[model samples]
Target: MSWIMPRRSLGHAISQLLLQFRIVSAVARRELQLRAAKGLFGVAGVFLEPLALICTFLALRILIRGAGEGTYLNLVLWLALGFIPFFMFADVAIKAIGGVQKGGDLYFYRRLRPLDSLMGTSLLTVQIFGTMMLAFVLGVSFWEWEFVVENPGRLVFLYLGIGLIGFGVGLTTLIIGHLLPIVAWVIKSFLRRILLWTSCIFFPIRQIPDEFRPFILWNPIAHGVELLRQSCNPAYPAPGVSAVYFWGWVVGSIGFGLFIYANSEELLFANEPLPGLDDGDADL
Candidate 1:
């Protein structure tokens, strides 16, 4: 009877996981539809925003280092790898800042939890950016007549790792922002500006002087970007990045974020009014 109960419990857990996946998938599809309708060119607009940003940065790269700067790899593929992963990370985390308020209506379905909505957004982001990266790489490969990624496995691992870090950061920020609305704004700004420059999106870590190298190394996103560049071009020089350090951030962020979310999940459904939204209260 004991052994049979254990098997039943295992089956139940698997079933529950499948059910959650279905729910998240449904939410993701709905989000895609809404975003597609709201953007410039229907579904194509999903790729447009990132592509425009990439083009702007590429122009800057060409101005600074000439059109043929990346001797180890094509400049297009090189920048795409850095931009795609970092954008996915920033988007996921920033969107999470007000996720509870935005997704409050989703709780109408008893089966849908707050986590599911966030997970759905993360899923949508991963899909969009992953597709963009692939399209960019394939286009560059065809143009250059050479395969861009030397280690496809490493590229994928770093790509997914960065997304996981974003999801974790988003989850953590979502809960914290619920307690203090101002924090959401601050974090969003920091991610967009500070993190963008610090994440090694525009340059490789090898160029940094020794004294500044440690500062850049502290950012896990930098490690992921540098490692990704190395993964694409085996000859690419990445001196101080490590997969172990990057994964450490991945595990720590997700673990801590999950802990916070699990504890404060009930607060998400409170539907508390924003500071300035009250009819008679001072807008503090």
Candidate 2:
């Protein structure tokens, strides 16, 4: 009887995990379908928006360097790879922030949880961006030169690490936005410009003057983009960047977000007694 009880408990845990997974997948599929139906471009705007922005940056580079730079196609590939992950992080953070708000009505069911929505939204972002990255690699390999992927596994880790940080910060941001909307808006607005200036996605960080490097070194996204480029080309140098440095942000952001979320689970949505908030927050 005792042995049977232990087996039953384990079975129950497994069943719960399976249920959560199904819920997450369903939500991800639903969002993908809904977003895909939006227009002629469909969800491809996910990639296109970043590409357009990169093109604008490329034009600027051309005007400034006046043909002294490397091949344009090579530049596109480099910037595209860098910008894809950077934008993925940005997009995932925004989606994750709205995960609870967008699916507020769905939380009526006892089985549905705030974390489920977060996971589902996160998974959707991963799917869309992962597909785009893979497609880029395939296009380069099949149509053009041999793609140089020295450390394929490490490259993937660098990409996914950015997403995790986005998700983590997003989870915490959701709580802040719910409690104080105005502050969240301000923070969100400022974060974009900050990330843009610091990430060095389209431009190489080395181009920045030596003394100024320390100012932007704090940005993990910059470290990630730089490290990712290093993984591809031997010529590019990222002396300030390392796997350990980038991994610190990935782990720290996730740990902090999860810790805060666990303690304040009840505050999510409209179910709680007291609505807690953040530094840059909006009203619930």
lDDT of 1 by residue, 132-167 (tens): 889988999899898888999999889999999888
Error of 2 at 74 (Å): 3.1
Q: Which stretches of model 2 miss by more than 4 angstroms?
A: 1-8, 41-73, 271-284
Instruction: Provide the RMSD of all predictions against the true structure, rounded to 1 decimal.
Output: 3.6, 5.3
Clash pairs (backbone) in predicted model 2:
180-281, 180-282, 180-283, 181-282, 181-283, 182-282, 183-280, 183-281, 184-280, 184-281
Worst 10 contiguous positions by lDDT, candidate 1: 275-284
**Model 2 agreement with the true structure over 67-137: per-residue lDDT tens digits:** 44243235555665677788788888877777787888778887888888788878888777777777766
In model 1, state the lDDT of residue 4.
Answer: 98
TM-scores of the models, in the order given: 0.92, 0.83
The best candidate by TM-score is 1
